[model samples]
Target: MEATELNIRISFGRKHALALLSAFFLCWHPGFIGSETLQLTTFYPAPYGGYVSLLTTGGTNTVPANTILARNAGRVGVGTGTPDSKVDIRIPVGLGANGVQITDDNANPDTRSYATLGVTRAASGNNLAYIGLTKQGTYPWAIGVAGSNDLIMGASSAGNRTIPSPMFSIDTGGQIAMGGGAEAGRRLRVVGDLRVTGDIYVNGRIQGLCQRIGYSITGVTSCPWNHNVIGFLGDGVARVSGFLPASATTSGVGRFIVLGEDWGGTMICCRF
Candidate 1:
């Protein structure tokens, strides 16, 4: 009998007969009717107008049923029956390759449209703003306002070294004016000329300013032959104990004289 007729006859048979006929039909209709394999090439497009289509090429055409083509098309109308619920849309992987290429092309300034990589400010007086690493490893030379045209006004290291203490530092080209400090234990040694307008008070013993007594001088030495007294001595000589004395006599024609006092003896000198 024909396959359709056999199927109709099996449908009305008793339970045991129906089972036997079902097995026979399965063996006979291997590639017939419902047993035929159906390969789906593409899904039937959804009736909705906003449904997105997924088309594939270069492979065996097999698409599963009920596969969501595009979850979110725009920043609105995704999953929600109302379009207002689609706030921020996302076209997940594979679906976004074409869209990304189009966006990149539009971002180029040479193209018709462009999108900014980041926020940018307008040029103010020929100056633009940028963000970058300020220092990598070594110490930077200087840092301050961009174009102020003034010497850095606050604490700075222009003429200073960081390793050593700068208490005795002196700027060669500039005058340093300090105020309101005891200034103890500070020693200043200058190889060049030092002009001081204020009084210098020495708290400790002042050395190396006087000649030693009982020290013989030869003719080759610069010492005066007449044993003229000069500055006071520090250790083995008479130290000048008080303020330096000035010449008492201002003579025009007669011999000039000076009278000074020291710790050992008084000084009386006459010179022309």
Candidate 2:
């Protein structure tokens, strides 16, 4: 039951005032018990025009501390009912929001916006790779401080150094090595020539063959300019990828020579 307040100002004796007040209370709450009295504190209005209150039974009071003040305009304020941002947070999940954005607009140089995970192992676990980036499920780029990092495809070098070398690395030192499985020693060391098993898709021009020092492709395949054919035959297979005359292989997989007609003239070729 709601307790009603009466503005009674009596110019009578103190005992008379007490009697009148007690009588007034007894009339309102007939089962008036001992000691308990109505707590009459004025409910203050919130700074943003809403009523500040306590949530009783189901809640803390008429206005609870943890209560979220939201509006139909898709805005939510935490400490203050009036949120400045879309979902304004004064102190600090939600059923609905368009997209989540985390930003550090300070534009500082070395600020990390995303989460960072540092290596927690011992010195034996040194050179442990931290982050790896890839394309088509193959790791092509990586950033790790522990191990030797060398971009292995550009060249093959026999220079093998101690562990903890930079196999492929990128740092503020302005040092890069497109070398093989070892320390590049200096700033840049492209060990030797490159070899691949798949087709080389070149967006730009491909220069002539760069043979190894003191040697040439003529030592391997009679034709020095036969880099294309050399690459095709590097697998030790004699099978031609393009259409080859049946007569070419009909001689039963042994060294044989044959004649063929070409746009220029009749040509003779040897096959094995």
Name the best candidate (by TM-score). 2
lDDT tens readout by residue for model 2, 167-208: 554434445555433333355445666667998787865444
Instruction: Name the TM-score of candidate 1.
Output: 0.17
RMSD vs true structure, all candidates: 24.3, 20.5
Q: What residue runs in model 2 are displaced by over 4 Å at the alpha carbon?
A: 1-126, 135-140, 147-167, 170-175, 181-185, 194-272
Q: How does model 1 fare in lDDT? A: 0.30
Collision count for each candidate, in order? 2, 17
Per-model TM-score on C-alpha atoms: 0.17, 0.20
